[model samples]
Target: MSTPTKVPLGSLPLPLSSHTLTKNLTPDRTAASPKAFRQVQHSQPSTQRRARLLSPETHFSYVAPNPLPFPFKIVPEEGEDVSPANQAELIERWLAAREALQEKDITERSNGLRLHFPAGREQPRELIGLSETGLRDCLPHLDVGDAFDLLGLPRLTKDPTNEEPQETENPARRELIDILSGYATLINVEEDVDKSWAPWSLRYSGHQFGTWAGQLGDGRAISILATPHPSNAELTYELQLKGAGRTPFSRGADGLAVVRSSIREFLCAEAMHALGIPTTRSLSLISLPELPVLRERIERACVLTRVAPSFIRIGSFESLNPPESMFFLGGGQQEKDLEALRILGKWVGRRVLKLEGIKWREEGQAGDAWGRQLVLESARRNAKMVAGWQAYGFMHGVINTDNVSIMGLTIDYGPYAFMDVFNPYHICNHSDGEGRYSYQAQPSVVMYALRSLLTSLSPLIGAENALGNKAVSPGWAKDMSDEQFAEWRKQGNDLVLAELEDTFQDTCAEEYRRLMHKRLGLRRIDLDDESKLIRPLTSLLAEHRLDFHSTFRRLAYFKPSLVDSPASTGNLESSKADFDAFVESLMALTPEPQMVDTFKAKIDWKKWLEKYSERIESEKGLWDADEDVDLQRERAMRDANPRFVLRQWVLEEVIKKVEQDTKSGRRVLGKVLQMACSPFEPWGAEDNLSPTDILDDEVLEERRYCGIGEQQMLGFQCSCSS
Candidate 1:
């Protein structure tokens, strides 16, 4: 309940020159911010920025030769009558092809997971039917920021672009809503004029736990449109309708997403984006009251349209080179599969990674050397991404290789949670019985994924050696004996893995240190800072079961200048009292109120404050000489420590309230989204967006749903059944 006021000290010891601090913060004045510290700006909503309106009649132009450049199966022609009987016939033929490829000897099956080869790499076909016609009546909840900035649509209520009659008026707005609702389609012709774009799902495989989970792909997700970035010409946006319908990779279960999970995915993606974490963006949430999807219970179905650079993942590569245990289902299509891997790798390198010319192919480097660069770049990006997750106390419950994005953006929001209490070993997914993807294990798990990616890329890496410099040849394996080919693959993977592992570890550790430094209001971090300050802070919070976000936020109020003042200055006792107040503030948000005094007595505040104060004093010169140093440091720390996170408890309340009353719940969702979009600012602080809603008093007020939950709700976990 108490807040610490700033205390001033004339000078501090070991202060570096202002020049030195300037260099440290901005080493190259002309260059951009370090990639490790970069934050996404599109997540924020601004009235001044406007984009072109998206409509069903508008052609979704794709920068790629083909929006989806993979082999696919043929289905009922657009005009053909796909009656139940005719559909059954089509399915039978598809099954026969699958049986021929699978050879019928492989009996191993769970969730009907099996390899599905396309009839041929020819015409693109519609994989599945859309949701029932009843969905057209529902309206979608669109993120104003995403609509305005990404899709070039005006906000219905509060955007300046509302003055534009066409954007604000009926048919255009209705058309946008229909496309998002999955009732209407966008025109497909783009740069690849000859290619017919259709709704398609990707096929891939990955490790579920630690073992290989064969043939896991997009079950409920369907890619429908690919459009150029509204602002950036070089960038292309691929929008996918998650929970759209079924595809070949749906396996046995019905491909549907429940309302609870869809809401979570929609909110968290924007929330993470607001937090400056690299992640996919949500365009809209279309609720289907007419259709109920059975998960653990019968819940209303919802379709979430998510936007990303590309949905390719580490598993995309792995799917091509399945384990030999798959009975070599790609046996007949081995060369074709290899070619697919090569093409996929090159596309990622050129488009996603943006490597090119000398950067893409160094002089005399193997033609496929970009493969290794792709792996390292992916490692670097992921290392920074996971480090951001760790610093913010986020645990992505299901980090299967399939969920790991090649672009290092956070994908698949299933069973994910932000830390309530600072428990290092907290498992957010109840289904994760082994705690394999726990908060503490995330970095190591990422390393596992990178290695899996490297293994998948081994054939491409070994192409030159296996083909005797004819790297473009797909049947490189045919030239060598099976043993020789295996040896070459192993050697290449080992070499690449050795280098990749080092890059990942070193990058992750460095990025983690940088983020931790920013979070703690420190401009400089020594080698011992982790042991003395960072790890100790973690231990102290876990020991007290203290709230993670609030603890760091409260520390911003503690004045480093006043800590350990000299007796001669007559401020020593007050300084010690001030530091005690800061410690009490940490216990202020603790769920175990009765244990607060006990925690205070147990923690070595004297020792911890000494180290923290000293570290702060060392970096004192980092502030501008003319500015107030404490205020500068406090602002930096507050920016790094968001006042609000899309906590699991908050999400639960929002979901419940929405089910109770649709209109009011929609308002609540928008209010929370506004809060999430500008997390660093307090709930009522202006960010040039929407005004504060009265619902904040009922929803975010203390003890209503504000602080971390108590009891079982604390560190809440969920089943992946959603």
Candidate 2:
């Protein structure tokens, strides 16, 4: 196929200002002649000498390839006038427009780099028949390579700028939006894409597993690809490539992601997002037929286009060489760092906590009390994030500095699992043999990561006063330092650490209480006075070995309200009620609660009821009746009280499906993906309350085998079954 020629529609109507080209591009070495270079450079009228230096050669050029590979069709909505011809024309026009921009020679003078989007050798699979909105969502697949390109650099061609038009209605805007939206929908991705892109990323380095690595960047991911939302143009969905290729920070390793790992990542990302956890969404999962990666064994390679509010991690800033110099004393670079920090802090405050700008201000504070507010907000979000993880029984397995998000969203699903059994010390990843990231240790792991981040931010904020301006403020005495900032950070860290310990203690106490209540046939104790509940519960558990889940679920039914309520129990004495009804219902003997024996259990029922009533009365006295209690706080406490865990049964169901597929040569991978995608929901229709309907021991054992050796077992099964 012939390369499409650029067709210039018209020049930009506005007069080009010298300020437009603030960053100078490097000269092209392959310029046909110096005169040609001068002609291109001098094309724009440059009133300022600095602007004259920023010739077209300094600008980066990127173009979409013609004759896309994917088969797609456009389906316009009702009353929409987007005909097939118009759709084709729109695509053609887009291709032509992009080509024109790419052909323009751009240079980066400081780096001596002529930025050019050299067309990829292979054409991407073009998806058609999508509406403009659909196309916007699907752009991730169309431009997978561009996602990888943005990984290494601090800024992309389309950097977030204050002067840029917040909204646009042109064909370019429509096309881009449609493409991105389509990408998101096609890949079943769902995360708030509006707050996804960042111009100048926060740069930092990290100590990976204790080794201080300097200048580590996006090794195999990029974020240049973004399409603004069609309806709200200010919102954009970013397309970041994972395992697309290598960057300056590849660290000698091939930046290729294997298909198995890619599948796991893609599914988990979407799953986490669906479960209402803040996380990066997977827009597209593309298998690279041409690339076979060797990791443990040779496997087919794939690239996942992941969309996130921003890819800025604590490690990003830590990896930079001379991080303190870059922020405090550096030239123009410090401004970028400061801006990034502020943006990150604001995002944590607003997006995570739902806090408004006005709430950040303090009564006595002046000049951006937002920083202090930000620290508290970050702490709250981090605590809640831990709680969410606990509720789902999710073990991140590797809560490294690089893996944690400033937004407190869980990203990078490597070696992650939903816990099967409630073993706090259970480590999912065999590689983490040291229990660095065990189920119970995640809170501590997260705290450590946050401390490292705060440590990195200390210099910028002034280590002494917990205020960032002290180091840079001229009014401060030369002798005065950020010593208070250091102390404040230590205090903040201590508070967070203490909170984590408290949370873990509560978790343990709650679990132990439930266990006791079940085995000893004791009524569930109110945790208002944890010491009272904990002492009795611990004693009961020590006295008798009992299953945790069974015990609590049984006791939950033994409520006095059921037997003593006037409406239901008025004629109980005349009806000759027996305790069998209570026992059978309490034991979950019948699927339907009404079918159980009608007898009310009388063994110490009055005593237990009195204790429960007394606890309630005591709580009311302890807490002022007039005082408004935060219902959300109470709900959070209730949620934290270990209930049903989705991971326990979903894993079993997934493993069973995998086993069946392996044995029967049937493709049940979709079901597995579905299970992972909605980790919180039960599988199948019959067992909506249960994780999975399958309960046979033999089947479970087979499924367990399938899960452990999924890749090999599936291949073998496919071969034999076929």
Candidate 3:
């Protein structure tokens, strides 16, 4: 057992500016008063418009150092040239590196846990040059707000020419845009610049669809830069390029992405952030017309610049112990593998989770305690994240262990969709034929991924058992007898698993309840309302195939006064007619609604509406005393239920326009992005004149972006290949 290092307790201070912090960390989000709700409703959009300018001295200078800022080594020495000298030797080294990584010492090349190398065997530099497209300028305003402000990056004017003519006239914005868009390198010696940023690919393995898929690493993704956060030096933000080129891990397929998937990922990342969900933000999306890629067909290639605190995944920890399947290709040294696991877990504890002030004991109990807490933290974050996804009707479509971010940020966007219809059992990814990652199953699957993460960290977490005693050799799982180790492992695993499940369930339930109640305009949780109103509401929506987003927003317009008056038969009849009219507005009618559909839907909907209205009337006083509670509730509902979501059909339209005509597509993309950034805001005359199909006609503008698509497009699904 290795001795634990005792470090003093420390705290990560919040950013000086509140706008720089994530939505979760902001204290104002928890305020329950109507005044606070109004403040929050306006604060987010205002924050999106504001930018914190960077000082000129540090703005353009590269902040990242040579070999990257992370605490790891890509090569044995600082300037070792491991690159093969000849084409024949390149293949030999590639084959040998794979074999060595699996069977021999995995960290022989790099001292750290991660096996870092270039993008491909022949392509020494992992940073691929990308061509600038019309969409380059459009990304600076993709609703990310001031996220990139702290990176010492330029804050582009809303309109380069109209808003800030000098910004467009100057060359600084253009030069920086080229860097982020991948048209230039980070450290340009030609210009005498020396930021020393190096790009590298990482190696990790995972369990794919419940089966151990050995050595599934970053095949198409490359980490281009990692720099200390301007607000807190302790934190670092990594910039990664998706679809840069093939890495050694690209098994047998071309490592490229088409504009179809790139645009979806690019828009979805920013949209998710705007919705106040924790996600990896997109900095830029650049199209390479000369770089055509083959998917279902040959499509123009593109690269998406992704930003996040950490890119570590559940598969990262799982890769520590090579599975039996790897033996077929080669084998792994168990001792070295376990050592790498310990190193990686410790690094994550201190760096990623930011655990500080732990009293390290000689027996290594501190590592166990930290590891256990890491699992709990991950569980809580994921629970809340999945809850947000459920509240917004989002389906990740791909929830493989490899895709699960350890920090719980929504990463690896692929074939993801926000449901048009409210169906609990909706499956957004057609490739998921078994429905393993269905909307209803997302919470459980996230739990499954967490369990996999826990299993990988069990050896470190099991150093000390629940009884606070060293049950086996502190950091080694195989030191004791097979029977004894199994017993010890079972006891430790059970203890941690129990705590994780409690955290996951409690956090998920609380967050989901809070979000749902807010969207429904309730002041607080009410079991009666849940059973009689909320539960029935879902059943009715699903029965009618009603659009999830529009239903919640339209329900805000329901006038409780119409049905809250005295229960006279004559009055009830007149109120019932008005109620029926309101109910018709909520229905997702396309082409022409069937009389039978409306008649049958109204029966269940009216029953639900009566219960809902009664609950709302009862809660009026609880909502607000100083203001009009009805108006307050309506405002709160509108704030919670966005008027726009980056739906699949909308993404298809945007992508098509960009592919057909880049010049006109820029305007369409920019307008849609603006709407995504301020989703709760109503479409107005300002938006009615945009040169896009979405705003071609003022009368149909809201329907184009806010309304549900045709019945056939309601439950649209896509394959994982997308």
Global lDDT scores for all candidate models? 0.60, 0.40, 0.59
Which ranking of candidates, highest lDDT first? 1, 3, 2
Comparing 1 with 3 on lDDT, the higher-scoring candidate is: 1
Per TM-score, the best of the predicted structures is 1
Question: Candidate 1 regions off by >4 Å?
Answer: 1-169, 187-195, 326-336, 356-368, 465-480, 566-573, 594-603, 684-705
Q: Estimate each model's TM-score.
A: 0.74, 0.51, 0.73
**Which candidate has the highest lDDT of all?**
1
Q: Give the C-alpha lDDT of model 2.
A: 0.40
Which ranges in model 2 have alpha carbons more than 4 Å from their true place? 1-120, 123-203, 227-236, 320-370, 463-669, 673-682, 687-722
C-alpha lDDT of residue 451 in model 3: 88
User: Tens digits of per-residue lDDT for model 3 on 1-722?
Assistant: 33322211011122222112111111112222223422322233121111121121110111111111111112333444555554333333333332211212132211112212222222211112121221122122122222222122111112333332112222334333333434343321111112112244454667666666666566567665554443345655666777755544455545566678877887787778777777887766666666657678778767777777778788777766443333322122222255456555555666677665554334544322577777888898899899899888889988988888888889899979997767899999988889889999999999999988887777556655543642223345435465654564566577699899999999998898888899999886876666777778888777776778878888888777666555643587787678768877666432335523777887787777777878787786686589887788888988898888888788888788778865445455656766676788865432344546453343355446665665667678987877
What is the C-alpha lDDT profile of model 2 across 191-214, one tens digit per residue?
Answer: 222211111112345555544544
